[model samples]
Target: MDRSRVTVVIVVLAAALALPFYAGPFWMGLATQIIIFGLLALSVDLLLGHTGLFSLCHASFFAVAAYTTAILQVRYGTPTVFAAPAGVLAGTLLALVFGIAVRTRGVYFILITIALGFIVWGVAYRWSSFTGGDNGVTNVPFPSIGPLAVTSHLQYYYLVLAIVMLCALGYRMLVSSPFGLGLRGIKASESRMRSLGYRTALHLYVAFVLSGALASLAGVLYVYYNRFVNPVTGSFQISVEVALMAIVGGSGTIIGPFIGSGVLLGLRNWVSSFFELHAAVMGVVFIATVLWAPDGLVGLARRLRKRRTGIRKDPA
Candidate 1:
């Protein structure tokens, strides 16, 4: 990374580390949410930005994982260690089945994902006995091990921060790895990649599964934080919103999704306080981002810097 970016990262980290001391409980909760959904948006970008596949059903995996953890803990009295992994497993298993959609592309792929997402939402909304219908599974306790445990939201905030930081680092390494380069190659030209003997289908399928796993992990974090799982958590709207988050944040970059998440969530919280049409406000923001910042906020920043540099070099 460049010096400017490194400086910006250091400043951001310092601010995050100091947030608990200055911000209230509500702000802490919101920050946690931004981190969680940022992970979800990042997962979507694994396919959208890297391999040029747009998936609209990531919320299915998120919901499945959340519901699995909730049900196991609430009904069966399972411990956090077992329930969390089970949730991840359940969602990953679903992803393995849904990976079949990787066979399709373009509009067909989008439609298939939409249908798949709706199926999960339908099951969650209608299957009252198993899923608790709209109410979902509730009373999920904060995650704890044999000795380590979270007693408050502030403590959880630090835990979430640590985990998200770790994920961001790992994700950086993944994107810099050879497999990540292969995904980019496929994105540039699948035919050319295939000509070079790359099994494009298998590559995309594996990415899809890995992306789903990441979404599942986000869901586990969310369920523990929110202490509930609802059909809305798995709804089509959520999938759309997270996709928009990735696009608005600069999908290919590690920090972009989190920045987008913070912007969108913070805007919603502030706007919804007085505006009844907050959803419309969000739509307008998306339209503006698409029109003026096609590559998203990070790209916009780079463009402005380049323009300034060009101006400085010219005779004036």
Candidate 2:
């Protein structure tokens, strides 16, 4: 990474670490939610930003993982060690199935994902016997493995922060590797990539699965933090919201999703307090982003920095 980027990362990490000391419980909770949703947005960007796929069914994987974990723990009394992994596994397997949509492109791919997502939402809403219908699974205990247990929200926040950091580090390596470059190439020109002997379809399929797995991890963390799982957890709106977060925060960058999440969630929290039309406010924000800041907040910052540097170097 460049020195400036590294410095920015350090400052962000320091702020995150110090948040608990200064922020109240409500703010901490909001921060946790932002991180979780940011992770989800990151997963979506794996396809939308890098692979040029816009999938709307990611909530299926996320909801499935959450439902599996909630059901196992609440009804069957499964251990965290087993339930968590099972949740991830279930979501990955679903991703494997949903990845077939990669066979199509453009609007068809988007429609297929939307259909898949609705199927999950329908089942979650109607299958009251197994999924608890619209009520969803509740009273989920904080995650515990052996003697290590999260006893408080503060502790859980730290745990989440640590896990997200590791995920970001791993994601950085993955994006910097050749595979990441290949995905970007495919995004630019799939036909050219295919002509170069790359099995572009298989490449996208793998990325889809990996993205689903990441979203599943986010869902698991969310269920534990929220202490409940509902059909809304797997709603189509969530997929849309996260997609917007990616675009608004600057897609294809590691921190963009998180920044977008913070902006959206924080805005919602603040706006919803007195306004009943907070959703409209979000719409305006998105429209403004598309119209004025097409490349998003990060890109805008970079452009401003470049302009300043150019001015400083000008002889005139």
**Candidate 2, pairs of clashing residues:** none
Note each model's CA RMSD in angstroms.
1.0, 1.0
lDDT of each: 0.93, 0.92
Q: How many Å off is the CA of 218 in candidate 1?
A: 0.3
> In angstroms, how far off is 223's CA in candidate 1?
0.5
Instruction: Give lDDT tens digits, candidate 1, residues 182-261.
Output: 99999999999999999999999999999999999999999999999999999998998899888888878888888889
Question: Runs in model 1 with CA error above 4 Å?
Answer: none
Residues 192-308, model 2: lDDT tens digits = 999999999999999999999999999888889998999999999898889889888998999999999998999999999999999899889878988998788999999999999
In model 2, what is the error at residue 202, expressed in angstroms? 0.5
Provide the TM-score for each candidate, comma-separated.
0.98, 0.98
Root-mean-square deviation of candidate 2: 1.0
Candidate 1 residue 144 Cα shift, in angstroms, is 0.7
Against the correct fold, how does model 1 do in TM-score?
0.98
